[model samples]
Target chain A: MELTLGPLAYHWPADIRRDFYARIADEAPVGTVYLGEVICSKRAPFHEPDLPATIERLERGGKRVVLSSLAEVMLKREREATAGLMAAEDHEVEVNNAAGLMDRGRRPHRIGPFLNAYNEATIAWMAGQGATHVCLPAELPGHSAAVAARAARALGVGVEVQVFGRAPLAVSARCYHARAHGRHKDNCQFVCEDDPDGMPLLTLDGKPLLRVNGIQTQSESYVELVEALPELAAAGVSHARLLPQAVDMVAVARVFADHLGGMCDATEARARLAGICAGVSFSNGFFHGVAGYRHIARLGTAH
Target chain B: MTGAEDFSAAGELVCPAGTPAALRTAVEAGADTVYCGLRNATNARNFPGLNFTPEELQASVAFAHARGAKVLLAVNTYPPAGQLALWHEAAAIGMRAGVDAFIVADMGVARHIAETWPRARLHLSVQAAASSPEAIRYYCTHFGVRRVVLPRILTIPEIRAIRREIPCEIETFVFGNHGLMVEGRCSLTNWLTGQSTNLDGVCSPAAEVTFERADDGTMRSCLSGFTIDRFAAGETAGYPTICKGRYAAPHRPEGYYAFEEPVSLNLGRLLPELMAAGVHAFKIEGRQRSKSYVRQVVGAFRRAVDSIRSGHDPDLADLVALTEGQKETQGAFQTKKWR
Candidate 1:
């Protein structure tokens, strides 16, 4: 299968974002790159002006680029931006909400995880709406993922799964990062940039629970699915999208690419990935139909 | 949109009914519209020992209709892949029962209802999580939704802004368990337990819920072996959802309500403001509650809506005692707070 770099879900300095994508375009083996802000819309202006240049750079590298719409479109400006994204004809658009779907009309678009397409009928309905690819929700078990992937294959739609990064667990209208910093959503200075990955949330027993990123809450542990790559491909998944993180993504991509090419052992690639993302935990419970924090290495073999 | 003349009285008193008795109690207590779900995963409140059979729903609909009240069927959960037929069957059963409208959340379900049962009236369930006018307008234009339930995240002015832009009717929660998480968008419970609130319509399924007492004389509520919230001795315990639980974060040694404390939402005081803001219905959100709760809360809202129309002050003092922990807040309606 192909490895696609998912949209950047966190806020970073514009220069860092620009440099990161530049390095990916130059060195990373990722076939496709999703560029745009899928989180808070307020973070758009910081990086939007530089997007055309970044897209140009990536396209110049022979990488396919897809523009992503916001996950939750509540404001008028966010809606207009979504409509504008749909109107753009140069690149493919990934719709994350119904507003985007409404604006897309007859255009062949990609459906993001935010818009739930759980069952076969949902996928068929989305295909009828001219959706060409769909990223299943992050909480699907291996069994469900296989079922959905097979269904997508039957409908001639490519299925994508989140193979890396902290899986998003929730999205809220209120900004938890701003709330934690004692500021309202409207007037608060963007405080989510403090944690380039995401701010960690712990349980009362001092156990890590989730990461807070503005209005989105994600699993505390990054979901590493390198071992499940074979199962995903066997299930008819066409793409495994890796969300960007504050790490050497070029090395991360190379490791994933090496695994796909059968040039590196799983142990060595995993060890290399571990060295890149130090002090971070990994979990694959959602893939096993168990608690999200639990790392179940084996799939249906478990229970 | 239906004209104000269709609802010549005060704001509609929309009530919740988990059981048949609760449905009858709510109707007898003067609820203008009573909403309930079938005994399946189609509805958001898919609790055990709750909801109705098809026959029970038909009888309840006739009872409510005889009393000049409308019964709405809530089929508001996302269907998992290959399980779409279940939701379609749910809508068909609701239509057979002669319910006035269907409250739906999933886009596929909405499309199915709009296409297969074009004559059926549709209301957007809060589980759809459409808080903006653009989102609501999309549903109205695509699915012919007659009303949209506002998610519990919008302020009064935001609701008013949406009311001005959309042609659909508005409904907002006036009482019950406050979901701090955005409706329809949360999967924390699904991450912990196999069931999903958005798809299976069950959150922290009872099968995965456990309460244990610590030696320190505190009650700890756990969902799927993970602690959701702990209560001190003699402290009342709320339902263990991952969002409203206490937790510890870095730099903060003491465990606190990292998301939100367990406080119920009480918008009773803002009945007049809500009516003036163009909310067509005031919804009471407790399908898992008791028949007495259904009777008392619906009765209070009925009187409050009447009082507001007659130019009298609403009596909402008694609602405080009925709330979880007997504490309430005008959540998100007054203004957005950091907590």
Candidate 2:
């Protein structure tokens, strides 16, 4: 399976954003790079000027670049931005919401994980609409992903699954990050910038439960599926997406690449990942068809 | 703004029907329309011991139509991989049963209905999360949707602004379980319990839930072995859905409702404002509630609509007792303070 770099779900300063992409383009062993914002529209302007240079640099480095649409399109400006992306000339557009579908028409595009393609019929229908690739939602178990991947392969569409980073648990029109910081979504004042990753939210029992970004809520535990690569490959998945995180992403990509290429074993790569994953725990329970917070390893047997 | 003359006509009163008895009760209680689903993952309220069978759906549709009331079939949940045929079969069965409209959420399912049954009237489910006019228009234009049930996150002014922009009709929740999370976008319960509200129509599946009393004489509601909420000695413990549970945040060391408090949504006081905002239908959201809940809520809303039509205010005090925590709020309708 090939490694694909998913979009940045958080807000970083323009310099950080640019430098992060530059390092990925130069050092990361990722084949496809998805650029642009997928969370809040208010944070787009901070990185819009750097987008062209970053996209050009990635393309110049022999990486396939795709522009991602917003996961939640509520405002008129968001809709217009989607339309503009659909009408763009250079890169493939990943449609995240229904508005993107309206603007895309029959053009070749990619369907993001946020669009809710749960079944084979949905994927086939999207394929009919000229979608060349489909990213399944992060909550799907291994069996469900296998079924979807089989259907997608039959229809000549590539199936991509999220193999790393925190699974996006929810998205809302209201900004929980701003609300936690004592402000409304309308006047969030870019407070989400304060948390480079996301603001951690704890349960009543002092257990870490979730992270609140601008309008998006994510799982507190980062999801890791390195050991599940055999099952994923056997299930007909073509690409494994690694979401950008606040760590040595280049090393992250290299480990996944080495593991996929048979250069390193699962245990060695996992030990290396554990060093950089920080104090946060790694979970693969959703892939095992159980609670997402639990990490169940099925090493010797099929799930 | 909608003038008094136009607002006096009163919007349609849509009620929920989880069981056959609830369906008949809602129709008999003056609900202009009653929505229901088949006993499977085809609908959003796919709880055990609830919903109608195919035979029951046909009978219920006939019962409602014979009384001049409409029956809308809810095929709203997103179908899982290799399981789209179940949703398709449900819609086909609903059409054969002569249902009035199909409430669909997934874009693929909507497209299938639009292509297969071009004459079928379609209503965008709240699970589709079409909060903006552009998103509503996309569904209306692409799938021939006739109406859209707006998500619970918008304010009254926001709904009015959306009404002015979109072509299809608009529906809003009048009362019921307050889903503080964004409709169709939340997966907190699925992350805890294997059952998914998006794919399986269940949030906090009862099969995985256990309420236990602690040694300190307090109550703890656990879902899949995770402590969702801890109730004090006398505090009532409602269903633990993860979102409404009290949680400790960064600065606030003590447990607080970081997301939302356990309260139901009651928009009875804002009936006039909702109608003036150009809402086409008022939906009461308790399909899994009791038959008495269906009767009382449908009857109260019917009376409230009629009272407004007669140019008078409504008396809806009895409905407050039906709330989850015996407390209610307008819930993002009158103000945006909910966040």
RMSD of candidate 1 to the truth, in angstroms, is 2.6
Tally clashing residue pairs in candidate 2: 0
What candidate 2 gets wrong by more than 4 Å, as runs, is A299-303, B1-10, B316-325, B337-339
The CA lDDT of each predicted structure is 0.85, 0.86
> Which residue window of length 10 is worst by lDDT in model 2 chain A?
A294-303
Q: Candidates' interface RMSDs, in order? A: 2.0, 1.8
> Residue A156 of candidate 2: its Cα lDDT?
91
Candidate 2 residue-wise lDDT, B70-140, digit = tens:
88899999988867889999989998898889999998899998898888889999999887776788888
- Backbone clash total for model 1 is 5
- Tens-place lDDT digits, model 1, residues A1-303: 999999999999999999999999999999999999998888999999999999999998889999999988877778888989999898999999888888888699999999887777678788988999999999878778898899999999999999889989999877888877767688769889888998888766667888889999998888888888999999999999999988888998999999989998777878888999998878787787777667765534432
- Scored by DockQ, the top model is 2
